[model samples]
Target: MIRRLLPLLLPAFLIAAAPASMADVQLKDARAEAQAKALMETLRCLVCQGQSIADSDADMARDMRSLVRQRIAAGETPEQVRGWLVERYGDYVSYDPPFSGATAALWFTPLLLLVGGIAVARLSFRRRRG
Candidate 1:
């Protein structure tokens, strides 16, 4: 039993000993800070449910925050930075996914369902009355 557990624990120890490649991000200018904050609010933390990267403390979120600062410091526009993250992590990382053909169903499904339910209710009431 000890031998079997050793293999599993070995990997955990190695991972624990690995260095975390994180940066201490401090946006030098107000413009960069503002842009980073706005963009962070729109980015969802992949490791967290219903939490924006800006509000998350997960390692992934910290790395993502650093990446956002780096991109902004490199003079990328807010839209470009968002696009870069989307390209890396896909649409799931975006809180406000773009209104494109693929996302139309997501955008309109709730409204469509509401209308369909109202229509069904009205038809049911009419049938019962007649």
Candidate 2:
């Protein structure tokens, strides 16, 4: 009976020990890790729908994570690295782009559409009422 119990407990023991064994494998430097995490969050996963690189587990997200860590380790500012990625991957890779000339439309287009829709609905309602 004790031998059988040891076999079951051994698996549990190893499972519990796993985290302590791999703690250093994740992130050793808090600040750098935070910077890498922030950069990754700003990037979208090319292969996943509506998933940011930071939250995705896809291969593309893993590659993006590696690139982000490399850029952070090389002393690139988060914004600079993001700019470089945007240049290489276009605005689709960015979860949020800086508001500027061409991107201005992105910021205002939805609001414009909402207002237009409301106006059209009001006009239709008035016509029905008249």
Candidate 3:
């Protein structure tokens, strides 16, 4: 009855609930694997903002790694794969997003902030002396 099937059904339920394995998709060629790894390092993990996809343990990072490997194995250059990802996810997905009109503020905001801080500090010091 139900008791006899419980053990078998338990294993099936566990398997269905388990996350997909990340190792199943990989490039057979060593060079392609290397390319995929390099590309992974350049991609930022959206879920783990501070980590590259290569260094992240997030499920999104794992999927990104799988996509890189599959694309490389299917003969796409690393740049092409990167372009596809950037197009789909926007420049934020890349650690080194291209310099362009849309991203100009992203690239220059740090410099601008630094200069503004220095100017403010200088003005504050002058006021204290006067």
Return the TM-score for each candidate structure.
Answer: 0.69, 0.68, 0.79
Which regions in candidate 3 have their CA more than 4 angstroms from the true location?
1-20, 23-26
lDDT of 3 at 82: 99
Q: Write the per-residue lDDT of candidate 1 for residues 41-60, one digit (tens) a residue.
A: 89999999589988998888
Tens-place lDDT digits, model 2, residues 1-130 = 9997999899999976554453223356789878878777778989995898878877667766777776777788888988888998888788787788878888999999999999999999999999
Best by TM-score: 3
Pick the lDDT winner. Answer: 3
Error of 2 at 35 (Å): 1.3
Cα lDDT tens digits for candidate 3, 1-130: 9999998899998764443464336677989998998899899999999999888988888878877887888899999999999999999999898999999998999999999999999999999999
lDDT of each: 0.85, 0.79, 0.87
Task: State which candidate, 2 or 3, has the greater lDDT.
Answer: 3
Which ten-residue region of model 2 has the weakest summed lDDT? 18-27
lDDT of 3 at 118: 100
> Which regions of candidate 2 are displaced past 4 Å?
1-25
Reference-based TM-score, model 2:
0.68
Candidate 1, residue 107: the lDDT equals 89
Q: Where does candidate 1 clash, by residue pair? A: none
